[model samples]
Target: MGADHAERVAHRVSGARLVAVSDADAARAGDLAARFPGVRAVTDPLALVADDDVDAVVVASPGAAHEEQVLACLEAGKHVLCEKPLTMDGESSLRVVRAERAAGRPLVQLGFMRRFDPEYARLKAVLDSGRLGRMLLLHNTHRNKSVPDTFRSEMIVRDSLVHEVDVARFLFGEEITEVTVYSPAPTSAAAEGVVDPQVSVFRMQGGAVVTNEVFVTNQVGYEVRCEAVCERGSAMAGRPWADLYTTVAADDGEGLWGGGVPADFLGRFARAYDLELQAWADASRRGEVVGPTTWDGYAATVVCEAGMRSLTTGEPASVTLVDPGPAS
Candidate 1:
């Protein structure tokens, strides 16, 4: 993801430069350094954070490593942009939030890039305009072709579906009060010993209800979509492209075909990535928090952990949140 972000930053912002990159895999780090001229490759991430030439750090490492890396950057007095699902669990997220508070400044920005998407922004605008009236319920679907074999079973909820969890919270503009996880019928595409699909039901603070379906069996393509039903109207957003059909001459007959997934996840979120980076960069320069803050990341992690507990126990789990004062 760090490599992808670097590419996007280079593409969108001509003035941006890749200074240094670090990863556990030495060869991979070397390749990235070679791809971006003048960028140094290192195995220790702390080195990148401590570099005198480095202005800021982008923490795109694994979910488990984010909290430490983010706090380290903050301790080093450098701004940080960390990727989503902020940490493996809420405890670590809280620690990072506290670290930011101790620093007396907003040094950490959570990467909830979907909030910057034009469609989502438009939806928010409509909601704020009172056109949707009182939002009553929300339905979100996040389907993918398959999950990597290396992915742990717990990650299905924490890392994979957490995207919808965060987005749902953002859209409702309220915290989730309670959550219940349901185990539906199994899917053939799902790996053994793994629940290929799951549904999470959330009760928001303002009496709004939300259901998120995270499925790993949409073999044809990858899809991320949402629908909001309010008192006055409804709104939906998803892939905007239409199927392109072409006539083919075959021995049997002429056939038409149309379907393809987004080339890559980064490609699908290209605009959001650029907007999120620019927002964080501009805010950092002005010494303010313009994007998602450490509190947002902590809240999302808390909700995700609750959802996981709900799934494991087959019982409704209530989320406990710490009021982190005003938004950073």
Candidate 2:
């Protein structure tokens, strides 16, 4: 993810330049830095944050390192674009939120790139324009071709399902009140004792319900789809592959017709990621932050924590978020 973001900033995004690269692996950082002219490689991330030439920072490091790096950026008065999870858990995420609040400005933007996807943006527009009346239900599907054996059941909730958690909030503008997760029998493709597919139901504060199917070992490529059902009508958005079917001649005199799916999320949402970074760069230039805020990150973490509990207990769990207080 860090390398991908580096490529975007150096080649695709405007108003930003790749000034430096850092990683625990010094050689890896050096190799990436060598690709961009005048870019330096730093071994320590905190040193990267304290660099004088770096006006703003992008935190694509491991989630465990996010709180310290983000807090360092805030203290240095630099804008930041941090990738998802915000931190490894909800408590650290809230601490980062408090640090941002103490800074007295919105300096951090969470990388919920789906919000910038063209189809999703159009769907959001349709829902908000009153054309759909009041949205009452959302159906989300998240699938992947495969994952490493190291990826566990809880990771499905934390890594894959977390995206849907934010989508529900982003589209409905309401907090999720509760979440219930149901894990069925594992598929042969899944690691032993791992949950390959998970079904999660979310109840929103506004009486709306969301259902999500998360299948990490679907063996059918990366596919994400969302449909919003409303009082008057419904709207759906999905991968462009959904519209690009092809026909092929076969020896049996029958034709095979189907569309191709992306091998990963990068292929599925490349444009969205570019636009997200561009928007972040543009906003940082103005000393402002845009897109998903720190609060969105914290909320998703809180909801995912509840989902993990449900995964264990096989029962619905109520979502809880600590009030950021009147100052927020």
Summarize candidate 2's per-residue lDDT along 233-268 as a digit string, tens digits: 998889444666678777899987776888999998
lDDT of 1 by residue, 15-128 (tens): 456788899898999998888768899789998898998888889998878877887898899988899867887888888888788888888888988888877777877887
lDDT of 2 at 155: 92
TM-score of each: 0.92, 0.97
**What is residue 86's positional error in candidate 2, in angstroms?**
0.6
Q: State in Å the error of residue 180, model 2.
A: 0.4
